[model samples]
Target chain A: MAKGFVAITAERCKGCGFCVEFCPTRVLALSSAFNSKGYHPPHIVSAEKCSGCDLCGMYCPDFAIFGGRYAR
Target chain B: MNEATLEIPYEIPEGARNPVEPFLRMDRMPHIWCAGCGIGTTVNCFTRALLDSKANLDKVAIVSGIGCTGRVAGYARLDSFHTTHGRAIPFATGLKLANPELQVVVYSGDGDLFAIGGNHFIHAARRNMDLKVICVNNMIYAMTGGQTAPTTPATAITATSPYGVSEPTFNLVALAEAAGASYVARWTTYHVKQLARSMEEVLKKKGFCFIEVISPCPTLYQRRNKMGDGLDAMKDYKAKSKVRNGAPTGECTLSKTGEIVVGKFVDRERPDYLELLKAQMIESLGDRYVEPEEACCSEC
Candidate 1:
């Protein structure tokens, strides 16, 4: 089970890939799927790798992705 | 592709709002920024800073001058004013004088703040006005088709400077310190945590506080210079940045593809304009001086 998860507002994403490129744990990647505006948003790659540091949240210029650690 | 049709690979819970949602005007969803613009990221740090500072939303006012970053005032969910081009500092000064209780923040782009409103910025800092100035220095003027701004690094090709800019660039950190700011710091978008922390510190402290945020303009600056996208610029920032606290402000030089010195360069306490005025009045006027009553209007 993953220790943390990222919640993405796919519709708000502009596909800049900042979150995917900067995620310390390499948990996300730009998905082939496109949003309504035709930009490729990111998707989870290895759920367990997510540390929920929210560095993705800080790097995301579009304010689309944010991470959180699950309560123990 | 509708949101429902395109399934994001992650299992997202329904009705989950991004923590930044409340601070932003959600109705203005889909902001006007480009795919890799960094202004919104700065806004995220700012909102986080505000949260950490525990500032009263009602008493915090955001002022902006015309430019891409200037749009922050409109998007922020607070008492915000979108002023004329290059006039954000003057407007903020007036706002601060009118209501001393309000924590006034002047947020604008490099062109708006340094190029046109240059004098206003220096004067405000000289007076040690209690204002928070956040300059998002993207180097080029992104909104105006990437024109060469005052802070644009040398040899960088901009819209207006087709032959490559030959003129020297402005040292924003040095300028802020020389202008008499009580606190000065420089950070790039990649250093979001430090940037947010510095911003929070500025809010808690008084007097003129300036934070220069070097952000990426991928659509224009990066693409024109063949520097790839926003992520590439961020990677460069991450690899080359050196954080030296208390480093002399005059030595912080920003060159194209060179090591960037980032950290708090100056922090000193100086009487703000309001404080100086009060002290002078009490000394000179003696018994004749009467304290100005607080805001009469309850809704101020």
Candidate 2:
């Protein structure tokens, strides 16, 4: 398993793309699919590379995306 | 190229909840902030700060004035008061005075704090009230359809200032420092880590603490100014920002397009309002000055 993972609630996303743009590992990208808000929520591009820093969470203005690491 | 857009098929941990959910009123989710609004980003930083500090939830009171940022009180799960426009500081002052146990926080926008409630802010800071203030500066009055605000940089076109503002912008950090704030710092929404750290620091700090967050108003400010979107604004901040911790507050003036100075400008010790009041009473009244707690209860 990857050291960490990110969970995305697509419906809550407004698609400002802060998470995808600022993700340190470049682990995410805007998906082609649209959410209920008609915005493209981010999808994991490199799941194993996620550092679970939650920088994505801090930058997510919509409160749509957050990351966490499994307990050691 | 096809793989770039493809989502990695992975299962989210069972029962995992977003970290921001607990700090916020989730039923009020899908908040009114427009896509790319940095107010929510500031809220995220605040929640993290609250959690990291492990403050008693019941003792924290979130007070907000009228504006988009004012809605923060409604969305937060803490003791909240959405006061009239520009009155958040006065209301917070009352809360702190009536019940000094509560950690009173005034969360409002630049227009609300610096423009509408500018006088109240200066006096509160002068008294060194035990209040933690978070000012989200989007540079314009966003909710009122983008009117130019006191902090709006020169040459920014807004609904009220089509030809660009002629008046000089207020240096918020300088004002706070001059007005006697015990702690003052400024950060952009893009500087999430630093912002959260400062918020955490303020939670434990006494006297008046102020943090000014320069946020992106993508819907109005950005769109009107021809800045592509909220993401573009973040990229702009990344390219321009300089972290000069403890830089003289007067030199930290924000411009429309210039190097952004951000960091802790002032962190010093000062006696707060309550302490001064207690000292004065003790000196003047001596035995006649009854302690607030020792005063007879209403039931008596």
Candidate 3:
């Protein structure tokens, strides 16, 4: 199966968790690290499990995250 | 070279850009909307629509009135205006009339568009002005402490309606149709794909187009009314929304507990304001009237 990955621009994330909450594969989690704005951004937890569905990007209002597919 | 050493390094491309980045003003990071606020979702769909419609970004303009949704104009990277409360429609009208080539979009909240700006809304629709109006109906005045709004559902608890709202709410879809709008649709944040498609259609359309986005205000409206958070509201929408394309506008009213009728309620053709004006001038003046070299030439 092809694996998908997501890249999150930390600085733009407002720690809304919409991306994490809406991720069907539950591969995202809010990170302890904070950006300059002091907001927690989403990070990949189970990289291998990502489906690259891009639901996180669709539901995200911040435009801080995006997803794509890759062959393992 | 050894097989291990000959392997190409697998690396994600550098400078990868988010697909929606070009449509947004990245400098305005960390937008003011609360967590789970549906306004951003609407923005996402809208930006996607802009991309899908192949609209000329330089010639597109976004106008917004004062409200939470009004902030859309500021976030959009295209030509945008943050107008006064309830005045976004009129402002957009002027922009469209002055520059017929430009695609004018009015993004605003229900309170600002329907309450304080109700008169402008009716008139704009009646004239069938060439404008795309996206009204985010969060059911309450989110920025103003969850006050009851014209789009608020009857008997819904709000900041100003502690005892539950008693006034009848405005059926926006019906109102738009009655006022002679050429295109009308309604969708929720949960329906992202559909919403984006609808926005694309609106952009391609010529006459007055209105899309009501039923979103959740988690911070104010939901919390005050015990409607749970944004996700919960979205879940309810998923369960309760009914899609009836081309349904009668009069049957599209949103009830407190009834199923939400969501779909393309109206789609038709009509001569827009500028088209009518040009025809009238040609008929009245015959060969004497001279057409302007350009619709709104800045040099002229």
Counted clashes in each candidate structure: 0, 0, 0
TM-score for each candidate, following the candidate numbering? 0.95, 0.96, 0.90
lDDT of 3 by residue, B1-300 (tens): 122321222344466557787888878866888877999989989988999999989999999999899999999999999999999999999888777889999999999999999999999999999999999999889888889999889888888999999999999999999999999999999888899999999999999999999998888888877888877888889899999999999999997778999999999999998888889999999998776555735676
Q: Write the per-residue lDDT of candidate 1 for residues B155-250, one digit (tens) a residue.
A: 999899998999999999999899899999999999999999999999999999999999989988988889988888888899999999999988
Off by over 4 Å in 3: A1-3, A10-17, A24-26, A29-41, A49-51, A70-72, B1-12, B293-300
Best by lDDT: 2
lDDT of 2 by residue, B137-216 (tens): 99999999999999999999999999988899999999999999999999999999999999999999999999999999
Best-performing candidate as measured by TM-score: 2
User: Judged by DockQ relative to the true structure, which candidate is superior, 1 or 2?
Assistant: 2
Residue B29 miss distance in model 1 (angstroms)? 1.4
Docking class of 3: acceptable
Off by over 4 Å in 1: B1-15, B298-300
User: Hey, what RMSD does candidate 1 come out at?
Assistant: 1.9
Per-prediction DockQ, in order? 0.60, 0.64, 0.36
Q: Once superposed on the true structure, which residue ranges of model 2 sit more than 4 Å away at CA? A: B1-8, B294-300
